[model samples]
Target: MKIVFLIAAMMATGLIDSAVAAPKSSKQRCEIVKKKIRDIESRMRAGYSASQGIRLEQRLRELKKDRYRYCR
Candidate 1:
């Protein structure tokens, strides 16, 4: 009975730790991506070439799509 109780307590602790360490929610991830997009746009406006800006925009779109698909 003592061993069983000890095992149960250990399991419960493990579960609590796992929950605490879980990744951020989808909304949080989306906000981070949005911020990144804005930062990229600002950098582009600061003198990056048109081609570079286009490439960065494409990458940002891809990142947003990926985040939307996986973060949720």
Candidate 2:
């Protein structure tokens, strides 16, 4: 009961916002993917723990695949 109430309150306050606003244009979508790829690459260059590295590498591959789809 308390947990449910807390979750509702958090969502109402936007503290746990999970909405994913996809880009409305192909150009914008491609740009977003490129930006995300850049960000993840930067984080990798900055260094990460083994588990985090694995996750980031996997995400990078997914982003690259999407980049091909969106950019061309």
Candidate 3:
């Protein structure tokens, strides 16, 4: 009886943990991507090198695409 109760308690705790540990939803992902894009754009405006600017631009484009895909 005690072992059964212990197992039940462990299972209940596991379920609670899983409920609390939710992954980022699509809206959350979009928000994060937008923030990163804004930061990168600000850096680009602040006189970044050509190559670094190009990389950041590419990343920004990809993030925009992701926003369209995920946010839709």
Candidate 4:
């Protein structure tokens, strides 16, 4: 009962905002993927461990795949 009241109060006060998102345009998706790749590259250059770099590269590949699927 207390938890329910607390949650209701929080929502009324706008302490927890709902996530309302619009679909991304192709350009926006491409830019986001490019930014993520650049971030991974920068982190690699900044001395991320080999394993961490590899994982980032894997994530980059996945992002690229998403870009190809959705942006192109």
- Reference-based lDDT, residue 38, model 2: 84
**Regarding TM-score, does 1 or 2 come out ahead?**
2
Residue 21, candidate 2: alpha-carbon lDDT: 87
Candidate 2, residue 35: Cα displacement in angstroms equals 0.3
lDDT of 4 by residue, 1-72 (tens): 998996785455333334656446878767766666666666667786777567667876887796787667
Which regions in candidate 2 have their CA more than 4 angstroms from the true location? Answer: 1-18
Q: lDDT per prediction? A: 0.60, 0.77, 0.65, 0.65
List TM-scores for all candidates, in order.
Answer: 0.48, 0.72, 0.62, 0.56
Tens-place lDDT per residue, model 2, 12-50, is: 533343478868988898997887788788878989899
Candidate number with greatest lDDT: 2
Predict model 1's lDDT versus the native.
0.60
Model 2 alpha-carbon miss at residue 34, Å: 0.3
Worst 10 residues of 2 by lDDT: 9-18
Candidate closer to the true structure by lDDT (higher is better), 1 or 3? 3
Tens digits of per-residue lDDT for model 1 on 3-72?
A: 7885685345321122344347767666656666566666667786677667667866776785777557
- Better model by TM-score: candidate 1 vs candidate 3: 3
- How badly does each model clash, as a count of residue pairs? 0, 0, 0, 0
Which candidate gets the maximum TM-score versus the true structure? 2
Give model 4's TM-score versus the native structure.
0.56
Better of 1 and 4 by lDDT: 4
Superposition error at 20 for model 4 (Å): 7.1
